[model samples]
Target chain A: MNIKVAFLAILLMALITYIPRVLPLAIFRKEIKSKYIKSFLQYVPYAVLGSLTFPDILYSTGALTTAVCGTVVALILAYFEKGLVIVALGAIITVYAAGFIL
Target chain B: MKKNFLYGLKRGIPIALGYIPVSFTFGLMAVTGGMPVWMAIFISMSNLTSAGQFAGTYLILHGAGLLEITMTTFVINIRYMLMSLSLTQKLSQDMTLPRRMLIAFGVTDETFTVASMEHGSLSFFYLLGLITGPFIGWSVGTALGAFICSSLPEALSNAMGIALYGMFIAIIIPPAKKSMPVIFIIVISVLVVCILRYIPLFSSISSGFRVIISTIIGAGLGALLFPFEARDNNIQEMRE
Candidate 1:
């Protein structure tokens, strides 16, 4: 691998990633009280996960669907307030199974 | 502080595992695209954002302008702004600026999710878990991927290459079932993205441009159309 290119890539990635983390906090501070702005933050995780989910599941590795299956199993198991380790393992099993089967 | 590092790793590993392949792909692509492996690994090490690396590599490979690259990367990664602000609240009050800045480098979707789940007295071990796993995974994966892509047959790799998307879906779907609001936001975002992607005018644009427009527009629209008052009140009320 080209060390220079890789270093450049890492530097660039760090810079890009840092922006989203730094800029908003620096700029908005406490001013993020608007209902719309607040609401946007609230729903962000879900929106992100959602957009990240389906098409990839459908078209990607089919493991997403499998992982979804695993996650569902996890959610059901989650009601017991099972520790995250158990839940994660459960999903891992589901992933292997899903990848193998589907 | 040691505890925080360990905690970060524990939480970071699963995320790291997920990130490894993605980074590996980046590594392979970088070398295949004509960049070196050490440089790619260094890139993975420093610039932990996946999309940015992918975008940058592509731009460089194609000889795109620096301004375009910077603008493109900025747009793609703008979401971290929100994650960081939320993270500041979560960090221990004792956290120094330098500490915060360093730890901030590890802020990622999975890491942030795991961190956000913390109740109190932030676990450095958790952060360590979160960071180390993904960091190692991404780094090692990149190194190995570059090696394999260079050495192995193409057809098999392509066929098995679908696992990365699977990981993403795994991340997206589970929480969605529990939250309608998130699901709604996602659907809207996807639909908007799909629409924007296929538009005659937008179709000519590169992936970088498309991602910029679609994410900003989708996120902007979701913020506008969906009022999150109930959710915010709940989190703040719970914290109090």
Candidate 2:
């Protein structure tokens, strides 16, 4: 792609991401009402992140097996209340070592 | 207060560290996919989104048309709209329009999680502090990754790609372990995604819409299953 064309695509991408974020806060200045809506919003983070992590993460590191190993390591470390960096590093190291063996 | 801003900055340290390896991998992949180093950096600098950028770049590499790229990005990132809508409940009443707009731009998954968990109304300065660190880390990591891709070993780079997903798992696991409702939501969402992936009837649904669809279903089910009780906390208060 031409540099100009690529730049335009990036600009459009930036707009889509930015608009979603800005629009909601801009239009909905008042507090949200309704118990159902609030509860739905509360669970959005977990549900969204969960769906994104699985299946996708399995293919992220180039192999299903290594990704599973890394995920297992991450879960174990996180279960122990490890910090984010520590848990992530633990998974990375696990996947890296697994790369050598498998 | 200065202390709150500093606290927010301190909290952002882990987020920035988490972003580096992920953004670094994006940079490496972009260059490998035939993008110029500067173009990859530009995309990171402008977008600051993981899934959206990844999907958009993949289409670009395939020579997808502009309309295709735009639609793909919109579908992939529509979750942020939901996240930002939730975050509006946390912003202080007196926050001005421009500040809300600026803060909204920084409402990535990590920042949203951190900001939402805070007790009181979120401050503009604190929000700025929180986003600035990760912003720099993400952009700089991309630049570094693009520059060093030739020298970095493929095995090591591939392994490092797991760091982002590891971070995602790390973020969700503790909370899910603590709350049965959260665990239910996560398990249901995963099952929905799996079914959508393998079932022939759902195979025609694109990946971007699949995420949006599953998220709505999972969150809707969670709301129905575990309704919120009235509470005095700011997070709850803001929504009321």
Q: How much does each candidate deviate from the true structure in C-alpha RMSD? A: 7.6, 5.5
| Cα lDDT computed for each candidate against the true fold | 0.56, 0.76
Query: lDDT (0-100) at residue B163 of candidate 1?
Result: 36
**How does each model score on TM-score?**
0.62, 0.70
* Candidate 1 Cα outliers beyond 4 Å, as residue runs: A1-10, A23-31, A38-102, B1-4, B25-35, B51-65, B123-130, B156-207, B229-240
User: Which segments of candidate 2 are over 4 A away from where they belong?
Assistant: A1-12, A61-63, B1-40, B48-100, B107-134, B145-150, B230-240
Q: What is the per-residue lDDT of model 1 for residues B52-82, given as tens digits with 9 covering 90 to 100?
A: 5555665565565455566666655555665
lDDT of 2 by residue, A8-28 (tens): 888999999798889888887
| Candidate number with greatest DockQ | 2
Best by TM-score: 2
Model 1 scores a C-alpha lDDT of 0.56
Kindly state the fnat score of candidate 2.
Answer: 0.73
